[model samples]
Target: MPSALLPIIAWDYQFAPNAQKSRNYLYITHTPFKICEQPFLLPRPALLSLGITYRRVPVLSIGKDVFCDNASFLDAMQELLEREGEGRALKRGGADRAFEAWGYRSFWVALASVPAGLVSKELGEDRRELFRRF
Candidate 1:
């Protein structure tokens, strides 16, 4: 069985937002797989072993096939579950479809489109300052 690796990192920061999404997909689809909570920093030997170039969390592994990142991972999951006609969430009118449809637009909008006043109000000055630096 393939294992979904989630890096145990802070959610508020921008780098590894895919862990939560990947975790939710696995749960919703009831995919039988192992969860490997890994460190937030340091190179992941597991990922390197799989020959996945992107050193990021939420990598899905099935034998030699490694789906790196949320988009690819979710797509792989959809294919795997849908091919057998299992995992209704990957079927028509599913939440997974809706979520993938939205993609990163909502995230970027939430961060970028707002006025400085609005962003500061919503995220607090300190967090907004950090984001600004990034």
Candidate 2:
């Protein structure tokens, strides 16, 4: 009999591509997890019901375990990989990985720093929505 997967969920996250790489790996490895998605800047009443009170985005919860920070979350993932044979190859570590992570972290910051005009006059909703649909 297979081990029953401990209901895994990514709490309230909207990450750019590189962070998505880590997520993509979980999917590729066939790890059992669920996405408890929440809208940005909103109270995650769903996560709160699970005993998480950190008030930060992008957490992981399994059984009684809840991880709040990204570093700790990745470290927990590393532990899971050791048991599951996901290894270092899958993780983009070292300088290149650091750069990509930096890029991922900075993406939203850059987007936010952009003038409001860019969001409206520059990238119209129709054009953005069209890109988003794909």
In model 2, the Cα lDDT at residue 10 comes to: 73
Local distance difference test scores for all models: 0.56, 0.58
The per-prediction tally of clashing pairs is: 0, 0
- On residues 74-130, what C-alpha lDDT tens digit does candidate 1 reach at each position? 676676667656444465555755776687667776767656555434345335444
Q: Against the true structure, what is each candidate's TM-score?
A: 0.54, 0.60
Cα deviation at 102, candidate 2, in Å, is: 2.4
Residue lDDT tens for model 2, 1-79: 0114566677656563433654665576566677777654435688767666665566766555777655666566667
Poorly placed runs, candidate 1 (over 4 Å):
1-16, 49-53, 87-89, 92-134
Clashes of 1: 0
